[model samples]
Target chain A: MATWLEGLIALVLIIGGVFLLIGSIGLVRLPDLYTRLHGPTKATTLGMAGLLLASSVVSSITQGSISVHEWLITLFLLITAPVSANMIAKTAMHHDLTPWKRTKGQELVDPASRQAPPSDHHSVKDGKLP
Target chain B: MLTWAVIIVAILICIALFLNLWRLVQGPSLQDRILALDTMYINSIALIILYGIHMGTGLYFEAALLIAMLGFVSTSALCKYLLRGDLIE
Candidate 1:
């Protein structure tokens, strides 16, 4: 392989590695379940994509044949990661997993505790209040 | 040069895998454990791909693909179980 191609592969590998490291660190260091979900779903998926991209490039350049397996894996990950994250988020919501104390939108998580409208105008407009 | 880069990246990924394991071991809740497990398999796929590159062979690609498919399915199934308390329902 040419020096430039080698550099490109190295660059991709390092970038993916850094993102993977960051994702796992976030998983370990984040304070709450909701926050922890951010790490693997987003950062790790991106890192995997980078790694697969590098693999595809390596296969193509070194072996002189188009390799679609990496592409297939990358596509699968990209398509499924968000779905799984959404499912996990739903599970957390179903279990009422608390977000980090500093996290906003607490009221959104539980509507009963949400503060009432200052004047009930909104409720009146919805025609629920009598 | 490529070898050195791959080595450094492999070490980094290994550390990442360890972190994932730490979370899996100590996660406070079931959802956290599931999330940690999800991350672990994905990181493993990255490691396997790295190994494949190091060996300059396409043989490992299938294994990586298999891991990816199984990881996604297992994650979804786990989440479904948590949400509905039943895998099929």
Candidate 2:
């Protein structure tokens, strides 16, 4: 019974690891900034959740109880990953970064694309960039 | 069985980590490097959690949580700086 459960946990871990690995590969290989942002934000978040799930299971089995803290991390990650991705995407836009040629036409869909508004220019005027 | 699985996953995650490092090093743009750093820290959390599972120790959980918190803060700060041209008004 113990070994069976361990095998199950291992299966979860393997899937999580593969997700994480693919996320990293995307981070390295994706053509442009905006497109690359999609990879780590989604896949890695799911991967982390899987690993945390495995941890929760292992704790329950070995320590004879469920651990709530891994779940906390899981929730924290789920909330923050998309938020971080949003911030990063906005920042990239503020920098006027371009998309890959293959993935062009973002300017048509996203009015907020590359061009900073007049108000954004005012902020830059008031603040000194490091 | 569990031990072998953990080792194999760890090895694969390490390869992932190195790929992240390569992106961090060779990334063409500042945004790309920042993204690389973000992904790397997240990978670290996965690695730590896997280690804790293998050892059956809850201690590493705290470390993973801390990394997650700090990583988010750092990424946000960088974004702020990039977006506003200044971190603080």
Candidate 3:
């Protein structure tokens, strides 16, 4: 392997590792469920993307062919991470889980927890159901 | 040189997994625990990919892909169950 290739892999790997660590730390230290949700859904997903990119690069060069599996994983993750996070957020709202005390936009959360959409149209209008 | 990078990243991901476990154990709410679990699986995917790179093999690709798919499914299912109190309804 060339020195530049080694450097590229190292750079990507270290950055991905750092982001992964940051996401986990945020999950542990964040004060509220809503706050904690931001960590993994965004940072960790990005971190995984970085790792997958590095893997694809390494595999493609080593195997002398394009690697499709890593790209598939990355695509699936990008599509699904948000969906899962949204579902979890909806779950939190349904349970009326409290947000951090200093969290802004307090009024919106109150009614969202109390409001039960009666129909598909209204649920879509409510902007809370997906 | 690539080996050293992979080793460093693997250690970092291991630390991340441990932190996620800590949160999973001590999370104050149901969703918090779920979030921790979700993060845990994502980190595991990273670890697996790093290991594949370290070994210079594509053999682990399927395993990583499987984990990614299953992790998302499980997380969404858990959230849905919590929201509606029913899995099939």
Highest TM-score scorer: 3
For model 2, the DockQ equals: 0.77
Model 1, range A21-103, lDDT digits (tens) per residue?
99999999988887888899889988988888898999898778787778899999899888988888777766777788887
Q: In CAPRI terms, where does candidate 1 land? A: high
Misplaced by over 4 Å in model 1 are A111-130
Worst 10 residues of 3 chain B by lDDT: B80-89
Write down the TM-score of every candidate: 0.89, 0.89, 0.91
| Pairs of residues at least 3 apart in sequence or in different chains that clash in candidate 2 | none
Which pairs of residues collide in candidate 1?
A: none
Candidate achieving higher DockQ, 2 or 3: 3
Compared with the true structure, all predictions reach lDDT values of 0.86, 0.86, 0.87
Clashing pairs in 3: none
DockQ of each: 0.86, 0.77, 0.90
State the TM-score for model 2.
0.89
Q: lDDT, candidate 1, residue B68?
A: 90
- Candidate 1 structure quality by residue, lDDT tens digits, B1-89: 88998899999999999999999899989988999999999999999999999999989998989999999999999988876679864
